[model samples]
Target chain A: MKKQIIYSLKSPYRENLDVIGFTFGSGEKSACIVGSTRGNEVQQMYICSQVVHALKKLERQGEITEGRSIMVVPCINYYSMNIGKRFWTMDNTDINRMFPGYEFGETTQRIADGVFRQVQGFKFGIQLASFYQSGDFLPHVKMMKTEFSQPEKMLEFGLPYALTRKPRPYDTTTLNYNWQIWETQAFSVYSYGTETVDEKASQVSVDAILRFLSAEGIVRANVKPGYVSRIIEENTMQQVHTEHGGIFKTLVKIGDTVYEGQVLGEVYNPLDGEKICEVKADKCGTVFFIYNKPLIMQNSVAYKIVDF
Target chain B: MIQTVAENELSVNEKLKIRKNTYQNGKGKRISIVTGTHGDELEGQFAVWLVGDYIKKNIGCLNGTVDIYPALNPLGIDSITRGIPGFDLDMNRVFPGFSEGTMAECVCNAIVEDIKGSEVCVDIHASNIYLRELPQIRISRDTAESLVPLAKMMNIDFVWVHESATVLRSTLAHSLNSIGTKTLVVELGVGMRINKDLGYQLLNGIINLLYELGMWSEKPDFEVRQPIVSFDGAVGFVNSDASGVFVSDVEFGSEVEKGDVIGRVLNPLTAESEPVKAVCSGLLFTLREYPVVYGGSLIARILSREEEN
Candidate 1:
């Protein structure tokens, strides 16, 4: 195991910001994994750390296949993480949006350029990503709808679902889309948590990466096949919205299978405690996302269900 | 007239409001000046205030409508942060936003929709906190043919034409240009603190532009300079080779010859100094305001005249 300084920026007050990457085995550039572009992505960092731990053990046991290399960068925005902020501490710019970045541009853009220059050109790129919304997601591997994206390769992750999403205007600058544009097949693995760490979800994420490595022949080890992964398109998901502004109470959780017209959550008047409306499933599907916030505004998205 | 473009109710008494003030005559060509996209850059706010006040005091002489958005991200300015405090989003990077979106999106939507059809749009800005820059006008290269003449009339020291594609499409100027509103971006001073001289100079520039555009009958009282026009490739940036404290030898807006010593990087522990020099003869439009810099940080931006068009 070798610890490398992928990028560094000098600070006046505090210590210089250094982005560290861990590499195991040495030969062909096989795979690269990035975690926690934002400071609040604790779960993603936890999963990557676990992956690093497992890969170190596998290297000691000589299970890593010869002539293959793998690199793991557990956290990129450590300054923000130290302050409990989500973006770059100085400019509040998101490192994720500045991929293929400008070396002479803003501070965040320089960091992005420095890091991307080191990580680009790998055969496969995996990013431990999180959602923009404050909610839970079922552990899944997501791929952008690009020419380089192949849904068949996602089955190796052994996650329950593999989702293909069309890139939005903002997504074009994301690490996943940029990787695909540069001819490196990119996959974003979304775990169940963002701000907090869920041990079960982290383990599931770490295992999924290991399973993918073994399947790709990067590691010569036997890993459990956890789930019969299903492929789904992003546009097919049904979004459930709230009709009233009130306190939100949901009994159903993410990944729960529900029938049509089933009660999902209830919105109560914030002042009276009386129920304003009850949110229900519109189609027979699996609850892929449940809003975890305690209050819901009118027309806010409360749930997203993937019809089976 | 005062109008609320967007509002967010964080608490009962605490609310975030994006307000716009307008002065109008019967009707002619409409012009909109917007600033305060980033919270830390406060010079634009002061310039807008000065311009807005000038228009208010001279409302009867106005030929067309003038819309001024003094503070777009009030919450950010209140906290002295660059991006919006709660959302952690840059207001400048969410232009032409969706109507049904988050708080920052809604604010962008409101501003874009309000100023979409204006005849002239001016986006004001201050340099980042790390650097101090001269008062200048920046227009995208693609829109240079139509906007350069107006940019030159802004009474600023330099007019820069940069590649539009190199910038993010989400920027207000880029979005406005896409919709046929050729926007001129004015960047001056430094972040956090206002440079009163440049602020008033830019304010006069806006008044001069309004007069040039036939939006106002009265002309600016002050004399404007013959602005030097620069293309994207003509700007030279001096970068540090090592992380250290930078002490600049020249001031912002200083003219330099080829191979002039512009600054030096000093290592406190080693007591070593590396002198930074200019590559060509031109105006130094941007200089490092903050002394501490990383190895890759820009020390100075010299507007070279080798290939000026």
Candidate 2:
């Protein structure tokens, strides 16, 4: 059992719209968890659940006195939290887009700077708990080609699949992608996504964290992770593009094994009821990714699968 | 006097005053028409402008008095925002507004005050433009039965009998009804563009409504027809997955059967297409013209389906 205060801080955007952060763990050593970054359901549903989880965890052990710290930002983007929206309701901006952060700026920038400063001091995991409200996104790790240290550390978290890919240069704000600046022992853990509350995903993520702590010698709990599978098969993944414009209905789920020439999805013209393209899997041993839903447009990522 | 509002405010001297045109027939009817609640939506504003021109040319030909607020959310119009500035509020939502509240509320309260005791309240709007909407009057069905017959005089194809709560919060009608005023909402075209046919059709229908309401003596040239569709059965939305450039195959205002191809998604670089089909039969009210969508983002909406009955 561990309990510590990593840092006490206020969101510069509190009076404005902002995300509220409460940290756990203590002293010089620490890890940070972006408990819930994107929120959209009944308002404060996630926050309320997280609070209950915190209370239960703290009560379970007397190892209450600790040397390491943990930061848990339960809710971000207060304005969106109120409206149950994912983006900043004020400017419709994604708060996740403004991470490591700007020192002297608006509410989001200021909050980003403060959070980054606090997290930089810790030596633990960066977990972003998110629920996909509209589209389907698979949970995976992203790293910059220069981030040699973090991706390797991601393995110990015991995720079902660990996608080691280069982070998009445009992703300057997310807490996970921001870790690339400090390569070694600094990485991210992204989870599978869905439109509504898939409690299983939440449990899976929580289980990952508990395992992560024990793996790092912080806890003495032996847990059997349900979806524990290593990505020792394939290394490189490529995005599949359609040749024309149309609606796509996918045949495979994310992370399923796929072969080249297999039917990945189907495309058609809506007005005349014509099947425009038979989107076949191109050069694949596994369907690491596929469009979560239909209504695709020209040049959209229909699938991302790789061969071992 | 001269009073400063927000940073976007025009100095009182810099403001262009709209001179009210007064008219008197043997009888009198006073009405105020409001348009452009959601900034980028401009068809209703254009209709009002066109109608305003007609009234201006024949100021003496009126059977009653009419006032027009062509663009209520001017800031929204400028930024193409769906709501007001400095607040995450919709101008249409804060009807009969609050005195001690945000800027949108203050403006809404003022509008409710101005339109007090008016014979009719017409709030005009443009659809999202992703789908073509038939010109229709949305009447509050549960309790606003009084305004429905008059709405039919507009001769639009559809009369949406949606309940007050069913509509978005803080709308003009919700405010008007709360203040004991009878209101009617008209929708046409899509946001950010001018649909000439729909615009002119709406202009004609509003004139007919005024005539039926006894605001004017001008008899409607065309007979008014109740739409074959009803409100409760007339609204459903269809969403798309893959985010990309949006391309559609259906025409606005066209009728279609179930499983029809109304639109499609395409891959830009490879020149591939993914077609979207209809799940029910009804009028294809609108279509998303621009591309770039997330899964489950709205792509089209069909009128009431039989199953909805």
Q: Pick the candidate with the highest lDDT.
A: 1
**Candidate 2 chain B, run of 10 with poorest lDDT:** B4-13
TM-score of 1: 0.90
C-alpha TM-scores of all predictions = 0.90, 0.52
Model 2 stretches astray by more than 4 angstroms: A1-308, B1-27, B166-169, B223-225, B269-273, B304-309
Q: Model 2, range B1-309, lDDT digits (tens) per residue?
A: 112221221211132122223334445777777787787788887788777876667655667777777767777787888776434455664665654333344556666777777788788888764545678777766544687776777768777677554324456776776666777788876768997877677777777877777765667677666654466656666666443456777776777788888777766666766677786797766566545543344677678456332
Which candidate has the top score in DockQ? 1
lDDT of 2: 0.59
| Cα RMSDs, all models | 3.1, 23.3
Candidate 1: residue B3 Cα off by (Å): 1.8
Report the Cα lDDT for residue B207, model 2. Answer: 74
Q: Give the Å shift of residue A137 in candidate 2.
A: 38
